[model samples]
Target: MDLRSHSKPIEEFNFLDPAVLDNPFEYYRAAQEQAPVYLMPETGMYLVSRYEDLRQVLLDTETFSNNLDGYGMLQGENWKVHQGILQERGWPDLPTLNFTDPPVHTRYRRIADSIFNAKRIAAISDRIEELCNLIIDRFIDRGECEFVSEFSFPFVGTIISEQLGLDSEKMSTFKKWGEAIMAPTSRVMTVEELRENAETIVEMQHFIAGKLEERRKEPRNDLISALVSSRGSDGEELDMMELQSFMRQFLSGTYESVVTMISHGMLILLREPGVMEQVATDLSRVPDFVEEALRFDTAVPGLARLVTRDTELAGVHLPAGSIVMTRYAAANRDPAKFDRPDKFDIDRKDKAHLSFGTGPHLCVGRLLARRELVIAFRTLLTRLKDIELARPLPEIAHVPHALLRPMKELPIRFAKADAA
Candidate 1:
């Protein structure tokens, strides 16, 4: 592949373009090779591509802020549009975990920390394994299946919905709602897209608020009840709005990313002949393979932060309120950080990938996501024999988004294995 053909002059580069979304590493490499830090002409935001620069920015929260107001997607006219739309309807802003910094972030993170604690992660291990088998069972006899929509999407979406005490039967709708709510925050959306997303968010919020009220009236052994009944350090229960905000964060965090991780991991293995066989032969390596897949092609490739004060990083002076975008995909593949950066090797000792992000904003659902992938792959390899792509490999493309990179479809065929 001639990388130069894909390269655009720094002034013309736009990560949201369809070509870049197809292979962002091309632009990431161009940016890194040209300069570690360069101002993006499309949004007037600085792009940080080097691993060290990105790591320092992520850790230096004092200088780099995660306030939603400064998020790259919400910057420029997007924020004004969003605020105006919400103000028109008199809606309250639902402060999400990803959009907040420490102290406040600490408080919100604590509210949901118990739900993803060691005990909870361990307790759900078996459930994850069971769900993997059940999901496979649905399409096993079909001989061929669309892995993304039919398998990965529903598998992770249903688990998240179930965890939130939502109707599992509505998993498809939940997937749609998740997409809508995340659109404006994750990428550049058209005015129509923004309006549709706002409407979907309002509908989802009403649903969550109703659930909160139900849990308040008659508590049950579910996440909504758990959250409603949860007491803070001050021994006060979380209010309805807080619960709604947390629920939005929970849904956004897990829904698309989990499915993307699973589908991408599998796609990586399948694309590389014999790698799948190597992992399938020794299932213990599945976890390491998953990590490498994350490095090679992360789900959430980049995130944005606001420059909080006059600061100089990598010799580039940045003023307060400037938006900085950290490219995790670029960082993960930085040759300065990883040897043979583009190669996927499970045996590599250096596994410090930025796929789950870093510093205070590391994904809270990291453990659950990893466990789901490992269990899903383990179950898949055990029950499906001689698995191979049901369609031409080149035909497989990713859903175009500014943040997420998930397979559009993965039609796979396999022979059902005998009872183990």
Candidate 2:
């Protein structure tokens, strides 16, 4: 394959560039047009954009390893400091279910499935709905709210914290620790930023380690106890390091993507005229609308995989150890896969999207996420009357990152409901 025909000059593409981060579809369109697979020399990443190609890569996990070098949570410079701190404390490298390949991945998945199964989720549906209403009650009377900080973060954060058997006071601390741990993966940071992030990483790890010991001594019904006591098919429990690894992945996965989906999904309804009113009038369409919102704008845009062996993908030859990025956001909007790809149509016959990914490494918490979104919108529609944007669309903005596109704030107004 002639590389010249597929992509413009290398100078034309820089994913980290602010312009690209703001709107990546144009770049995805160009890449898919020229070459479904294009090598980004600056970042040493082979970006796979088209729907079919990305889908193939996701399914062909044998060729692509989940554990990509220099791409995990513990990647880059600052993490080295974090690694040293962990080693000094005798903690092993925290590799989670998402960061491993087969056998190990299989075992971890089974363990995770036991807890995040249909039975467990269905049992909690009422509690989740009750929690949603409780959260809304705090702000519903005000007739105005900053949805992200006031509701999205704390609402989801508190639930996840409770599941993990953490103290109520630890909710805010989790966000700080999450930012500190994930910031390094998104971009280059200053020395001060790196140091601060490393320090927080140590703090969070210490806290979790203590909880692990507590669960070991006196098991409870929460996820922490499950991690401490749950046995694999072989009837063996994960060691402390393994347990911590699962905790990191579970906590991060639970809070970040779910919050992004909920907050951004609402933002989409606000931007698309009449959509909110449509859902408000007819509650049945809420699920479809949420699905469309996820497809239209995925929270986690893409994920990285390391090429395990010399291989060819979409006409591009990739050497072993190459970093390949599967762009789920781009794949979700591929014209070949969906008609009028850019348009947000809830009634589209084919609603299958890669927002939660595909194949073996697909997000384990997807069911929980979908349920949360549905209940959130349902409760809002029932509790608040005549919902509308509190501020102009232009004022609403997003914070860009390499891994995600999250709204910065979402201000909205609505009338409170009568006491039931």
Candidate 3:
């Protein structure tokens, strides 16, 4: 596919435009070729679009700090107002896993890493497969279902919710909390919306605080229990505010990205001829398909990094204290890195996409997310056959947000495969 011809100049491109957000490849291609470190005129933030450039930014943690001082989303006037609201009515919004630099981040990460270690992931594998089959069983016989709401949402939400010892029946409520937590970073909201989301987040924090206290008293075989009981390298347990902040990240980071991955992966299967058949025929290929799906349409396209000092990336100079948005989706499709980057070729040998990020701040839940996708698609292809889009491509809509590319719905029609 030719990604060369953009109608407008790079400087004229507005990252906040909903149209651009919906379909950003053309703009991404232009920026990659013309200005790899393009500055957004509106936000004064530098957008690093090249794969190597983004990788460099991620590795050089000293230069590109993750802590945005609660400025990751709300900026200037909005940020001041947001801080006031949280301080007065709710817990002070503090940086945890994805928002902090080393030393401090290391303390939090060490605890999180132990909880989501290889053993834990392996132990949960059987349960993941079982959940996949159970979720599939609900809509497989119907021959038609909204993939996002019916499958991806509940499947991922239940697993994460259960791990956190939350009520699975209240997945919808959890989703709202996640969205509210992410709203400030994803898009510019009105003051009213910000206040409302702030209230919801405070509610979520209180709810988590209550859970933490319960776990402290009577530890259960759940993540909340583990977190409450776990200690850092210094043998210091996380305080109440720290625990609340960590849970906030866990809730926001774990859910939507996986849901988007599953839904988008299904969309790819329906769009690409014979790919589904290939995966169904040989289950081993599901992993490759998942990797390509992640590369082709990265769920969390980019994340904000605070520039700690003056730096030059891809020939563009960045000043200290500036916000740099690493465009992982664009970097994943960089022609310099992946040949035919725009095409979704599962057979391609290179699978080093920035979908889960890299370096110190790499996604903590990547293993779990990958396991969920593998089990989900593997079971989905095994049980459901002849999957096709129920509606036309244009009819399917994505939620309008700057940071995430979550599909509003994925209506699909399929027939149940004969039991083996």
Best TM-score goes to which candidate?
3
lDDT of the candidates, in the order given: 0.79, 0.79, 0.86
Clashing pairs in 1: none
User: Where in model 3 is the C-alpha error above 4 Å?
Assistant: 4-8, 70-72, 394-396
Count of residue pairs whose backbone atoms collide, per candidate: 0, 0, 0
TM-score of each: 0.92, 0.92, 0.96
Candidate 2, residue 389: the lDDT equals 85
Rate residue 416 of model 1 by lDDT. Answer: 88
lDDT (10s digit) by residue, model 1, range 104-128: 7887788678767777778778877
Q: State the lDDT at 8 in candidate 3.
A: 61
Cα deviation at 18, candidate 1, in Å, is 0.7
Model 1 lDDT, residue 218, Cα = 92
Which residue runs of candidate 1 sit more than 4 Å off their true CA positions?
Answer: 1-13, 70-91, 190-192, 393-396
lDDT at residue 256 of model 1 (Cα atoms): 85
Q: Which number leads on lDDT?
A: 3
